[model samples]
Target: MGKPVLIIISGHPATGKTTFGKMISEELKIPLVSPDGIKEILWDNIGWKHDFTEWSNVGKVSFELMYYFIETCLAQGKSLVAEAHFHPEINNARLNALKDKYGCKLLQVHCKADKSVIEERFRQRMASDNFHPGHRHGIVEVYGEEKFYDKLGKGEKLLNIDGEVYEVDTTNAENIDSNKVLEFIKSNL
Candidate 1:
């Protein structure tokens, strides 16, 4: 069997990563892994808010763990698609290491559907995210969309730091050739 494709769909939780990831996984006939799903599967152990450390540290640890999970599946020659925020700043380094370690291919698919679509998605996600009353304090499953966009703008600053990294804006990225997205990946590869 051929080596499996390690596709990491990175975007905010509500931003169609799950939807697009599922679509790609189906099209490619690969196993789909969502960090959110993984989190939910181990929610009690991992907890909701990983506010213990800086963004990069927590993400680095999570990325390392996810890397192992994805790599194991890949080594078994199983195709896999990973869906999550996969924060670039923290996860990219480990991804690079994984690429070198296992000859694994890394495709960072940026899920950028429209804002309204994203808002709707998040609403549905928060509702089904196992929200409990009086369990966790200040646990509101709401996305600060504007804040997220603002943060994304800031994060883009780091993009140029790594020329090999692929970038795609899937905003209005459905029902057509997400060729720009593909081109972004092909160029990087």
Candidate 2:
């Protein structure tokens, strides 16, 4: 068996991080750790208010759970893909510490898209009934559309970790080079 690998998929909202991460995880047969998935579970069981502070707190807990799961997998010498809107200032140190402790190979796939596309996608997501209520209420309803759009327009803040970085332009989902992405992951691992 080879060394364990951590494939981190990160980007701003509506950048297709989750979609790309899911593809990678499926193709590579790696377990996926997603904070949003955890947050949805929490919202389902514990309940949530349509308030920013409440949503933020739930998000924090989701991150904690994601870290715990990642560490557990690493401890067992397992490779996995983790997807999140990772803040550099907050997550870089934590990820570095995990890498050091587990001696795992790290790789990051940073997804990016045009700002206008992101705004449109985000709006579509917000309006879609299929999406989790937490996102619709917590993000736009609580934070307001202008503030949320402003945040999205600021672009992604990627984690500062020593790793091979693959940037994917997701402006047009149909245009993403899945074969190239798979090749990058295969080469790294």
RMSD of each: 5.6, 1.3
lDDT of 2: 0.88
Candidate 1, TM-score vs. the true structure?
0.62
Q: Report residue 37 deviation for candidate 1 (angstroms).
A: 0.4
Q: Model 1, stretches more than 4 Å misplaced?
A: 44-64, 113-154, 157-170, 173-189
Among all candidates shown, the one with the greatest TM-score: 2
Best candidate (score: lDDT): 2
The per-residue C-alpha lDDT of model 1 at residue 91 equals 65
Taking the tens digit of each residue's C-alpha lDDT, what string does model 1 give over 21-108?
A: 7876776677887655554444456454544343234344555567678889867767577877755676667667656666666666
Candidate 2 residues 1-189, lDDT tens each?
388999999888889888888999999998999999999999889875646777788989899999999999999999999999999989999998899999998899998888999899988988888889877777757778777788884744677897899998899888988899889999999
Q: After best superposition, candidate 1 residue 28: deviation in angstroms? A: 1.3
